[model samples]
Every structure is written in C-alpha cells, then in structure tokens.
Target: MRDTMKPCQHTLSDDVVYKDVVVVGNGPSGMVTSFVLAGNVPYLKDIPEDLPIDEMLRARLSNLPPGQSLYDADLLELAEGLEGRSQNPISLLMDNLLRPCADLGIQADSLIEWRYDVEKEIDHVVLGRGPPGGAWHTFPPQVRTLSPGAWLSLPPHTTDSAERLTASAVAEYCRRYVQACHLQRYFRCNVVVTSVTAAPPGTGAPCSPACPRSASYCVSGYDHKEGRGFRYACRRVVIAAGACDRPNVLPEHISHHALHQLAALEKAAQLNQQHPKSQSRCWWWVRGVSAADAVRLARASGLHVYHLHRTAADSLAKLPLLNYPDYNQVYKMMCDGASGNYTNYKSLPEHMIVEVTPLLSPQTTNTEEENKIRLKKVKLLNLVTNKTVELTVYIVAVLIGSKPDLFFLQTNFDLNTIEIKKCKCNEKKIDEKQCFLRNHWHYLKSVLGQSIQSCKSRYLNYTEINGNIDTKCALPDCNKRDTCTCNTKAERGLAVRECKCEIIPYSNLRREKNCQCQPTNPYSSGLGYGIDPKKPVDGRSNPVAIDKSTHEMFNFPGMYALGPLTADNFIRFIPGGALALVTHIHREMKSE
Candidate 1:
C-alpha cells in the first residue's frame, strides 16, 4: 500500500481549502442543513393530542425533559425506536413537528423549540450555481409552488400564512433565511462542482483534532464568479444540489424555439411580443407533473396551448388532490377536454411527436427577426390508434422532468466496481424468524409509501379502470402486481398480512449492485436509484443509498445525500434530512 501521509503519490492543488464539511447546492435543503450545522438545535417544546406520531416515539419523547435539548444520540434513539414510517425517520419527524397532522386537518402548534448552541457548531461551506434558493431563482416570478407557502419555509424560521407562494417570494425567503440564521458566511454562490473523490490519507489537516476520520474527501470545481478553478478537502461532503438543474431532453433534434421550463417560456414570450395577438398558440409535449406549471405560464402569457401527453388521465391520480389544488385543476382541464371554460387549452392524450421539421414559408427582409419567428410542423404518433398527425406552431415546449446532476460522482469513479458488505444487525440475531417478526411492520410501511396517514386505501383511493379497481393487470388470468385492495376499516390489519413483498433493508440498497429500491419519496419519478454507467442519468438516477438514521451513504463513509437526492423532495421534509446529517457529524466529532 502507498503511504498516504507522504506527499509523493499525487499532486495536491496549492490553493486547496480545507473544511470539516462541504455541502453542494445552497437551496432549501442546503440552507437548512447549514443552519443546523451553524449551531441551531431543536428541542421538544410540547406534544399535542392525537398528532398521528408513532406510539413508541410518543413514549420516548414523553420521558424527556419539557424543554430537553435533542442531541445526536437522542435523535438517533428516537428514530430507531420509531414505527410505521421509518424509511426516513428524521424527515418524517421533522415534517410532523413542522406541520403537525396537516393531512388530518388538525391545526396544531409545533412541538419543537430551537436554540442556538455555539458548542455544537461545525465548520462547513455551502457551494451552489446561484444564490440560496437553488433552481427557484431560475423559475419565472409568476410560477407558484404546488404546496402552500408554509410548506416552503425553513424550520426555526417558518411562515403562518396558508397561501401558495410565488417563485420570487420563495427565492427571497431562502436568501433571508441564510441571513436570519447567520449562515450567509458559509454559502458560496455561482460555484459548480466538477468532481468529488476520496482524498489521500493524511492529505491535509483533519476537521478537528479528535475527528481525524473526516476531511478525507477531496472536492474540485470551478468558481463562476472568480473565473478560476477551486479545490477543497473536507472531512465530509453532502450532495443537496437538487434534481432540477438538468432537464430531461428528447432524442429528436428540434428548432431553437423549444422551451423546457417556465423560465424559458417567459423568455420566449418576451421575444414574441411583436407577433400579432390573434396568432397566439404553442405546442407542448409534457410527461411529468412539472409540466403543469409550464402550461399555466403559456396560458397566462395569452397563448392557447396544445398539450400532448403519453399516458391517459389515470396517471394524474398520483397527485394528492387536497394539497395540490393547482395540479388538480390542471388534471380537471385535461379530463374535461378542450371545451367550456377551458377553451384556451387542448389536450392530446396518448400521443407523442415523432418528428419536428421547420416549414419554409414567406419571410421578411430582416434576417434576425425572421430567424426569431418561424413555423414548425410536428408529426405526432397516437400510441393507441397507430396513426400520425401533424400540427404547426411557433413554439414547441417539451417538459418531461429532471434529475440531479450526479455526473461528478460518476465521472470521477466507476461505482460498479466497488465492493459492498451486508449491513450488520444492531443486536445479536437469534434467528431469522424472530428478526422477520420484529421488523415486519417497518417493511410493510416502507412498501406502502412510509406513512399510515398518507397511504392510499384501495377502496377509497384506487383508480377505476373500465369500471373495475385497477389491478395493474391486462389479462383476466394474469397475476396482479403486488397491490392489494382493503377497506378503510381493515387497511391497517389487512395491509400488514396481505402486502407480502420482499423486505429489503435500506442499508442493503447499493447503486453498484443495481438493486431496485423503490423510491420512498412520494413525488419521486418511480425510477430505481441504481446507476448504470452506460445509460444517461435521468431526473431520478444515481441517488446514493443512505442510512436514514445518519443520512450517510452505505458505501462511502464520510459522504451524505440530502434533500431531493434522498427522496425528501418537498421542502417541508428536507430539514429532517439536514438534522440527521448534522447530528451524525456532531456525534462523531464529540466521540473523537
């Protein structure tokens, strides 16, 4: 083995900076994580009646002091003891505290009390492409969040209003959050991370005197503002950069008039102001829920939209109607077709454009102006009818979805070659039967989307297909996909017994091994986290397998995946991922 201490192996950048922890992305997740690491700790304030929390969790908290400060150990213990929704306990706990029983229509006070403790502070730096709001800064000001304003708030600095917040408002709130929490000094905007690799042993000073295990990772990137390359060797690194940076692009080449996001739509609207008001129509090919916002933007800009989607109206059922009113309204417009009050919209279900060709029509003498405006004919393929149709429009916007840019991790290392070991049980295993019995509830909850309150009952929430409950089977004799139907009264008891799918533990999920750990995040793309080096990274691929208790990757020791990368896409739940990460690091430093 090469000596890691001797500076003879590989050249270290001369301007390399060292820190205890380096967080990627200064978005909501990044901001929340930085705030916790900056010494803000949450304590138990007061538990309310019927909060829908795990019974064991309630018992554990009841024993603690009225204003007891929850350290890493306390949090880890509570998370481990939690039942029913333990896939990401820290996130679940945080969501419950921040918005207590929101689904049940119970307006309860927060049970958490936050206090600043300089002793718990960790040395860290947050790096992002833009300011604190991440992708929100890039969205059009008119676009609003699906959830209410309170859902977008960072903990310890929350909002009481229930109205939906605009993109600009959310961005401003994120910037103000950093300043309010005194975390501005740790955030570095306009920096793009290029690579993150294991540092040479004894390459630089450790995070602290005792925690020598950290500061073993080397991060390299480019500083956009400074116009120079930068390097950092930190004890630990957190990937919170989020999934919206890279939009999923179609394979077919099209004209420059194509728009992927609402921001681009806004830009296109400004440039086309010279066009006649009567000739206002845009062609859109959309897939995921994100496209709903784009449709709103197009209509708001006085453009009639011709929306095309691959699937039928059933796919829209995945969105929660109560929380996502805007999405629900969009779904209603699609279902009702292009008539009545929704005359400005046109829905083309089960159809996709196969080809886009620019039409050669009459042009003006001004070359620049003529190039800016043109007509394109799109060939659409109806999947059900096997027919092709063509339509002409000024703009073609394809809004499928997006994923986090995990290219840094992939390009730096071939993850497939890494060896993985089976996770050890916390206590001595007596027998396989007993172990299964003890962990059966957790396994069931993980498969059913991790929350008893959020699980959709078969009788109440199942989509009807041809007048029958959707079994996800085409033929009459075919076996149904593991989904079971249960009445509301028997939901808990029947689901536990009938939902007998494989109970793979979170620690066993390995990207290199290509294990299919279904996405626990409700809004996830339903794509497995495994990374196939040969394939392109979509909006959901390359998610690191993390230990929920600590938010640390199983294969990589000092690395953590936070926010949407961990399946906690919603802002309300990201703070918990942050707490898990900070608490784990704080505990390690204290132990050393």
Candidate 2:
C-alpha cells in the first residue's frame, strides 16, 4: 500500500504544471490577453533556466536567414514559397519576419540560445481547440467588421489598410499578430477544458518563490490529438470561451404532433414524384424565409410558393446583397418571382400560427390523438381580413432566424448567471418587446426608403442630363401639379421628364409613436437590426459577471471574462477591453 501510494503521488506531481495564467479560450479575448501578458507584462517575463531549447530553436530558424548554408537555404526557400500561398497565421508570420532577415543577413544558427531566452518570456497557457483567431475563424469570408479597419487594430499590430476588413482578413491578422510576437509556443490548441476548480488550500501556494500570489485554480482538460487528460495549476484563469460557444435552442411551446405532419407531407411528395398523373397537389406556405432560400426551395419543390412578407414592396435591398455572382442571380430571381405570388402585408400578423381553442367536434377530448386530428385542419387568422380561414396544410416551414449559441453556458452555469429575463412593465409605459419590434420595423423602412431614393436619382440623371426617358414614364400630357402626372419637357436642349413619385411614408410604417431606444453609441447599439427576444436585452449574456475595470469575475478571485463573454459584442471593442484587462493583471501582479 505504501509503495502504491508513493507511485500515485509521483505521477500526480509529474502531471501538473504551474503557470502564472491560464486562458480557457483561444478566441479574440484569450489571444489578446495571452499576447499582452507575454509581450508587455513585466512579472510574467521570467525565463526559466531549464526551458526547452529545441522548440525555441525551431521557431527562430523559421523566422531567420540560412546565411551560407545550402541545405538550410533550400528548406527556407521551399517554406517561403509554400507560405506565400498559405492562409495559415503562423506561415504568414514566418514569411513577414523572415523576409527582412535574408536581406539583413541575420543567421539562424547563431541565434539558437538567444531565441530560447526570448521564447521563455511569459509563463501562461491558452487552452482551446478553436483556430488561433477564435470565433473569427468561423466567420464567413465576406462578413465585414462593423467598425472601420483602423478601429480593429490590436496593440503593436495594425491592419494592412485603413478600410473595413472581412472576417477572413481579421482572423488572418490575429494569426499574424500571434506569429510576429512568437507567442505560438504558449498555445495548447485542441485542448478542451472540462472543469475548473479551486486548488486545495496548501496546493494553492506559489509554485515558484518569486511568485507573489499563490495559485488559485486547478484546471483540468482533455487534449483531442493526444487523447489524454492534462492538468494545470495556475495563479489566474481567464474565461474567454465566447458567449456564442453554445447554441440557445429555446423551448418549443407548440406540440411536436403538428411538426410531424410536415414530415408526412414530404413523404407524400416523394411518393407523388413516382406517379405523374396523380391529381394531388402540394403548395408551400413560406413566411419569414429569406428571398434566396425561398426561391431555391420553390425551384426545387416545383410547387406554387405563397410568400408572405410584412412590407409594402417586394425588394431584396435590405438583404445581404453582396458582390457574389450567385447572390446577384438570386436577387434577379426574387424580383421575377415576386410578381407571381408574393403577398406584401402592410402590417405584421398578430400570430403566425393560431391554435384551435376547442376540438373540431364536441365529442373529442383534449387528448394527444384528438389534438393531432384537430391540428390537421387548423384555422389561420388573417390579420388583414380579421377572419379565421381553415386549411389543411401538409407542411409548415418555420424559418425565423438564428440565435446565439449559449448551450455551454446553460449546461455549466446557473440560470440567473446566463438567463436574461423578460422586461417588466414600468410606470413610464415603455414596452421593451414592442420597442425592439418598432426599432427593427423602422430600420427596414429606412433601408427601403434609401433604395427608392437611389432609383429616383438614377431616373433623374437619365431623363434630365442624358436626354433619355424611360418608356414607362412617357405618358400623355397632364397637369404639372397632378400627383399621377408624367410629362417630358425640354430643358437646355435635353429632354427633361417630370414625374410625381409616390413613396410610402416611413412614419406610417412605424407603429410606435415614440422610439426611446436610439443609438447613442454605435459600439453599444450594434447593427441597427432588432435584438432577438430570446437573447438578453443588453445582448449576449456571459456566464460570469466581472469588474469592468479589472475584467475579473466578481464571485471568484483571480478569474476573468472578456470579449463576447462580456457585454461588448463588437470586434472593435475587443482590443481595447483586452488591453485594459491585461493592464489590470500586470498592475495587480506588480503590486503583489
């Protein structure tokens, strides 16, 4: 028993390594914190005497010249050629650092020991499997930052140009920053942190005599590639795993029996395809679906699509109409398809789906079987008609939109820690939900108005300046003051067409008399889009609340949360927030 105990103790001691800080995520917040600590923090800049030399030597060689060595030069040349075409951050960093080295004649062989000491500056560990740039890695190629390019600059690293950057470019920039600073060795990618607990009282003591404060946490995680569990004893832990790490799937108030009928309809469609002469018909009732997806679905199903939208005009102007050729095709398709079956509702429906208050027959009880039977022929209330119309719908596709991934927070943290409660009625009579809805409706109205304004400007330019008038605008002479009048007049030897343009008043579209929710700051308000009701009113909720000044968790000492994990969701704010936290951490360490 004594021999076995000794072996277990030895194994446990060998498994755990001590560090000054442990960042639990590899996203923007974690990467920036790690970068700052490694590069700027004075106390953490201690190089251990027994630090690994081989890893440092390899890192330095990748960023230095081969000098007169043929073998090294060839290897470096090959690496540079491959790296030029590579999007990998490390590769880009190596290229950036090494390009100047060859011209300067800085040899790799002579800098082995010097690089080793430089690599050992910071004693921190970043644990996560996410790409080096964190959530930016998952961003679509065309996804642009809300702020201008200059606002996204991290300390000691600036963007290539002072223009708005796409997600891919921003992510690459983050990678380059990491590589340029030589902070790659500190990252433990593919490491998933399972649990973080307070270290045992005595075990919390500093691993090194020089460390002012004792270690506070024992972080345990599993490595994907290694297929083994690892542990770390660290003085501080930063939780920057990101708020959207988990998906927030709200509770479905409706029963599954209604949704199941959709599947039955799909099966019937498949079987109908086998028999062409069948009189059976399948129609799609699309509501709140994107124009692109709706067209694709309609084309694929070959069904008469009834597109119900809450707008006066059918326009793809508000949608994400980027420069992609496929998107352009989709826009054209949507415009052509709208004339066939699009119903632009002046006002939103009271309820998308109406429940059958009582069973169809008096004999039927509210049983599951009876409910399914009743739901088959449910009544849909028409907001315009103020009447209920009964229909036998084979399937219903509900595509509202997506919410933040908050599943991780839900499973790990308590409800109050992450749950955002619905707004309460106050004496001021402000309906929070209604306020959000009105703001969104107004924003959409503004976008539509802008589109119409652009069209009017082009029409004026063609008629007055170019002397070319649209055939649609060429009409018989009418009174100049008439609202429906369209007449062509000569101006400076050019044909000038005068037409009364009728545009929907933005005020009429907005329901709320007064909108208290105005954008005081672009950084805090986010994009003018309406906030999802399922999300916290403030935005995404973090698992741990932290001090704004220190970025340290309120409940747990030496623990911090940053980036999207906090209130700020924009990329522009991340660098500044991270810098503050890093600065606070350094100050605390220095004081101790």
Candidate 3:
C-alpha cells in the first residue's frame, strides 16, 4: 500500500497540507497515537476527494484491532526480540545488524550516532523537535524506570525478559520502536508547536458545507531546520506534551525575604571559614520547606537542619538519592547533623530582629571583634510547651517546599476547569506574618501533633510498669532511683544502695526483652519517614483533566492529551493511556 501511494507533495514542501490528525508531541504517547491511527485505518492509504477527512480517517476502524485487545502476536514477537538485550530496540537491532563488524572489533558508537532517520509515510504528522525519544532523552542517565522495562514498551514492541530499564535505555527503545514499526516516516522532527488555534474561517480545505469556514484546529509552530514558522491545519490535534516540559515555579505565597535571608546566611557561613575554631552556629528551622529542598539547601549551606513535619516524608523519598550522588551525601549529612524533632511554635514574636548589642566603643571595636559580636541568639516559642527557647546561632534557615509547576497550563487553559487549586495543605489564608512560613506547615504540624501524642501515650504507659507486667521502664532518672533491682543476683545486694538496672541504649531498649516500652518509628506515617513510600510522589497534583473515554480535553474538542499531562505519568500507565486515547480519537473521527 505504501509503495503504490505517492507522498503528498505539500507535506514535502513548506506548504500546509490538511491532515486527518496532527499529533503535537513525539513522546511515547504521540508516537503511539500516530502508529495506531496509521496502522489501523485503511482510508489513510488514499484520501477520497469527495469524502470528509474525519470520516475517511475513521472509516473501518472496527476492522482494526480491538481497543481492549490491541496487543497481538506481532507485538509479542517485537517484545521477544527486545527482551534482555537493550532498552532501545533500535539499538538492539543495530547491534544485531553490526554484530559481524563488532566481532571484527569495530566500535558501533564510533560507526554512527544512535539515531534513525524517520520517513514521512503516514498522512498525519507527529511533530516534535526533541530527540526521537522525547522527554525520556532529557532524563538523567542514572534514572531508572519506575515501572518494569515491559511497562515502558510501546505497542507492537516489548522489552521482553528485561525487568528494569534506565532512562537512556528507554529513550533508545523509543527511538528504535519508531524505526522498527516504520512510524518514523510519520514523524516531522525538529518542529516545535508554539500554538494550536482554531482554523480561520473560509480558509484551507473544506471538510463539509455546514462548517465550510471552520477547520477543527490549526497547529502553528517553528521549524528549526527552515528557521521559519510553519502551520498545519488538521481535523484532530493530540497534545502529548509531557508534564515536565515546562518547569513548575514556586508559589507566590513563598516569602522572598526568607529566601534572601537563607542566601545571606550561606554567605555568612562561607565568610566564617577564616576562624575555624570559632565556627558560627547555624540552626535550620524546617517549617515550610519541602523535604527535598531542605536537604538540598542544607547541604549547599553546610548547615544542620531537621524536618519538623511528617508530611515531608513523602517529598523526601522522591529525591533522586541513587541517581545523584550529591543527594546521597546530603541524606547522610541530614541524618547525622540534623535532629528530626517536630515542634510547634505558637504565639511567638512575629519577627524578632536579634542584633548583637555592641559592648565596646565603636572606635575601639576591630573588624574581627565586630564579626564575633554580630552572632546573636534568637527566641523561638514552643507551641507544645509554651516556653521560649533562646537558640544561640548566627543564622536560622527556614525551608518551605515548592508549589506545582502548572505555569503552562495556567497560562493556556482555564484554571477552574482544570481544577488547579491551592494545595490541600494550604487551607488557611496567607497573612503578612505567616507569609514567611510554608503553606503546608499547618498540615505538617497536625501530623507532628499525632506523633507527639503517640509518644506521650508510650511514655505514660512506661511509667506505670509493674513487676508482673512486661513493661518498658520509663524511669527518667533510673540511676537516681535506688529502688530499682537487677535480675542478676550479683547486683541484687547493690540494688538498695544504687540503681542496678543496666543502661541499654534508647534505640536498643525497644527490642530488649526487659524493656517495657517500645519507641515508635520516628518517621512513620502513610508515606513513611525519610522516603517516598509511594513510587511517584508528584501524582494527584497539576493534573491535565481529560475525559477517560476519549482522553480528550473536556472543554476543547479535537484536542486530546495523555501521559503526565493527564495525571497518569507512571511508565506502566502511559502505553495503555496512549492506546485508549488513539482509539477514542479514531472512533470520534470515524463518527464524524
């Protein structure tokens, strides 16, 4: 069929060729959509002049593979070939093709760049300027697939026996999949979609008389090769732009002053290096900071910090500890240097400026003396205890977590329809005083309160320990208590005069047979302490709402989305979602 049909001349040129579909991404989702549409629909082989494009594209979609059972023997074969070899099936194929040369000690990496030239075979164009792998190409080399290698596989291609895959492998696999399936011919690489606007009235090819002036959509973008803008009018548009394409910015509520203060503290710390013996003391008040950011900033500043909220546990786990060596070092530093003491600060001074009161005359005080005197103490009120503790430190660093990166969505779409709202933790209205704190502090405080209550209950139970009961001894000063007895007879005689109970470490006491009270895991919660119990921590937020049946934008007809854009960013869910979306588009186009 491909050999018999001549390629559209307009597509070859810079001129606009009205297509049945124009997929606006080259990611897994975009590639799958193009493949499914081209492979299934036979009318794409020859667009009838009299028939409407949508109707022509959708015709006989039923004859194609069933949506639910799209995976078949051909796909299985591809999977088998790809299994246990390489993440990039194309790379694997190339390796196989060049194996004879490799046996003669030829270097494949030196022979060619690991990229395939895609042919523009299908009527529909898959537009992306990025590497054939899309967002996967930008992923860190050390990053591994959250889902198994098989889950990362696109349709008609499988990862085979491989259980896991790295980011590079996934990228290569995508490139290879495109080449192997001959889907590359459909791709228009090096074209970035700038905007998707409604087709201008009374322009382009007419699909029907009822909407003679209207085309469903016109995708306009810059072509890097041509160094000029290009537009394509299409009956359907699929937006497979991954979630991370546009970086999310921190929320407006976050205090710039606090960040400036942190920067100043960092500068001050750097200056204190000259006097190693008299190192300035730094205390990080981790109230609003995300666990990930806290660790990062703390490591950068060389400051001792602590997480005061259990909510940070989830964010902490999402940090790429394994992929980035710095994260591992920071994790170790946080564990060793900082205390994970969750404390509530209530009814405190809003902003107390503590500057060292100069004792010596201005003329007598030298620069070194002035620097020493500049380090002063700050008072913090403990909400639980209602006591003000003066912490003698040069600077206090406050870490507040970052907000979702929905800048692109907010700018492009309606926020209300998309359901972009303040975080669940950001319940209270921000005030001038509270602006310095994190939005999620209240939520973290509540979790801390629960932990504290649990700890108190354990402490109370320990104090009530009896001789008959297998109780953890809660005697605060067991050494001070002369009434304590030991199990050994040798220490029994000394029990009346001195406390004979062996002093076991607090952590070890939990598992000790004689210890009555067991301490709870300090970081225990739904997400666990210091790690993301959930695989993808950023789920449920910054979602691009889509109709499940069609995977289309609820408000925008002819516009579809998938992958992280639709709240299903995991590797496992992307392929299925891509399939369903394409199927829906096919059915919808067919109905037209």
Who wins the TM-score comparison?
1
lDDT of 2 by residue, 1-592 (tens): 1111111221126777877788888877777777666754221112234433234434544454433221123222323333222222222322233221322222211111112223223468898776687767764445455445644655444433435667789889878877887779888888766556666565344333234235577777668898886878777777777644322211233333332223233443444356553223323332332333433443455544333333322333443444233434544434454343333211222323564233344334455433333313435566666777664433333333222222111111222222111211111233556457545865754644322222232332211111111222222222222234333433321223333443222343332222111111111111111132212322342223556556666556777766665655555445434544555655565455
Quote model 1's TM-score. Answer: 0.72
User: In candidate 3, what are the lDDT values of residues 1-592, reduced to their tens digit?
Assistant: 2333334323312455576678877888787777666654211122234422223223432244443232221222222343222232222322222221332333221111122112212357899868677877765444455455544655544333334566788888888888887776789888856555565555355434113233467676667888876767776777776644422222222221123233334344455445563334444344222333333544444544333332223333454655444444434433432243322111122223222222223435455323432444455445445655565554334443221121111112211121111111111222443433434555754644322333333334221111112223333422232344422111211101123446443332232112222321111111110012221112244344556555676666777766655555554445545545555654443444
Highest-scoring model, lDDT: 1
Regions of model 1 farther than 4 Å from truth = 1-14, 48-54, 65-68, 72-77, 80-87, 201-214, 254-257, 277-281, 312-326, 338-342, 360-373, 410-542
Count steric clashes of candidate 2: 5
Rate residue 3 of model 2 by lDDT. Answer: 16
TM-score of each: 0.72, 0.45, 0.45
lDDT of 1 by residue, 512-569 (tens): 1111111111112211233433233332444546887888976678888877776666
Clashing pairs in 1: 214-235, 215-234, 215-235, 402-539, 403-539
How does each model score on lDDT?
0.63, 0.44, 0.43
Ranking by TM-score: 1, 2, 3
Error of 1 at 450 (Å): 40
